[model samples]
Target: MDAAARARLIRALAGTVIAHADELTGLDQAIGDGDHGLNMKRGFETVLAEADTLAAQPLPAMLAGIGKTLVMRVGGASGPLYGTLFLTLGKTLPEESGMADAAPALEAAVAAVKARGKSDAGQKTMLDVLVPVLEELKAGGEGLPARLAATAHAAAEATVPMRAVRGRASFLGERSVGHMDPGARSSALMVEAVVTWLEEQA
Candidate 1:
């Protein structure tokens, strides 16, 4: 990515999260501490504030820096899980990566997230959205950005019917059903934002 694209991607991701903070908070209020939105917002706001410096770094280094920033700024389980995702991606991806390289990097990142959260796809967490999105990326067909955005949104919605098996929502047991997972929703939002930006660039 060029400097402009890097800056744009950072804005897309962070802006989406910050823009939907209230929605995420509403989702969290159902089964969690109702702070997911606030935490994510704060973290992304910091990211936005540091966008110039982050965009100036090499791709892998930028990702690693973002992960470290998230780990330091964001609170709750999301901080570590999201941090691990980016950190692992930074470790796995080459500085100049192609679409082919992205699948393996994302796969590794997903694994790291699972290990960090001690959870998996069916757990009504961010993994629900991420895992399916990874599958879509691996499939690698035409209109991939649109497909990925669709898959991400659908996967997040799929979490609505599932009872939470991890995180604070798990405490609600059956009551967690019929509500969207805050993490999953947030993940989907970010994915959509990135893909949308990619589509625009293309």
Candidate 2:
């Protein structure tokens, strides 16, 4: 996607996070500190407020700025984890390209997030959703947004049966199994927002 499209996707993602903040907070309450929603909302609101400035930057610069804002404004582990994800993407992405060109950047982002969080897939973390989405992007095909939407949601749902081995939810043991990981849910929502914006572009 182009810069404008990227900006739109970010805006939509901010909206999605805000809209689902309460639900996210509730999910966190079941297994975490119950602040994921508020943290995400505040971070994304700052992103929205800085949208014009961000959109004006080069793609990498814009993404880096977004990551920085989230890191600075958001609370909890999510801030640093998500910040690293986006910052890595900014650093890794190639200039002037499409999803195919974005694949490596996204892949690098997954690794960065994994390292930053010191976590992996099937651990009831955001990686449950992100890893699969990265796979889909790397494969590169038509109806990308549709495929990403499905994969993201499915991965997020799959977290319902997983035991958290990382982050605050890890403290819950079996009790965390049935509850959806708030970070995974929020990751899915962010991906879904990207899909929505891409569909509009098409």
Candidate 3:
């Protein structure tokens, strides 16, 4: 994606989180700290506010700022986990860039989330959506954004039937079986937002 597309994608993420804030809060209430949406909204609000400054910055720089903001502002496990994902990406990404290669960034992001979250595909975490979606992106090559949207949507839907194995949901044991993971749900939304923005860019 180009500089303009990058900016728009980030803004769309921020807006998507804000738009679904209540639903996110509700989802979190089912299996987590109940603040997934709230904290994310706050972090992305900070992201949106800094958009002007970040507009001309490299992708890694923009991600680094977001990571720092989340680490500082958000609370509980989300602050550290999500913070680490973005922070790791910021540290790992290429420097002196032109337009970012979207697929690689998404793949890196999925890896960061998996590493930080410390859970696998069957755990019904964000990995269910992220891992498969990244795989599809890598496999499809072209039409990646559309595939990502389908994958995320499928993963989010799949979460409803699986038991939670990570985070606070693990505490619930069998009770966690029915409810959706807040993080996974929101992660799916994030993927969808990126796909939407990518389509618009196209």
Estimate the TM-score of every prediction.
0.99, 0.96, 0.89
lDDT of 3 at 127: 78
Off by over 4 Å in 1: none
Q: What is the descending TM-score order? A: 1, 2, 3
Give the Cα error of residue 190 in candidate 2, in Å.
0.6
Better of 2 and 3 by lDDT: 2
What are the per-residue Cα lDDT tens digits for candidate 1 across 1-202? 8878888989999999999999999999998999999999999999999998999988788888889989999999999989999889889999897778989999999999999899999999999999999999999989899999999999999999999999999999999999999999999999999898888888
Ranked by TM-score, the better of candidates 2 and 3 is 2
Model 2: which residue pairs collide? none
Model 1 clashing residue pairs (backbone):
none
- What is the lDDT, from 0 to 100, of the residue 179 in candidate 1? 98
Residue-level lDDT of model 3, residues 34-57, one tens digit each, is 888898888888888877677677
Q: lDDT, candidate 3, residue 84?
A: 75
Which candidate gets the maximum lDDT versus the true structure?
Answer: 1
Positional deviation of residue 123's Cα in model 3 after best superposition, in angstroms: 0.8
Could you tell me which residue pairs clash in candidate 3?
A: none
lDDT of 1 at 49: 96
* Candidate 2 ranges beyond 4 A from true positions: 1-4
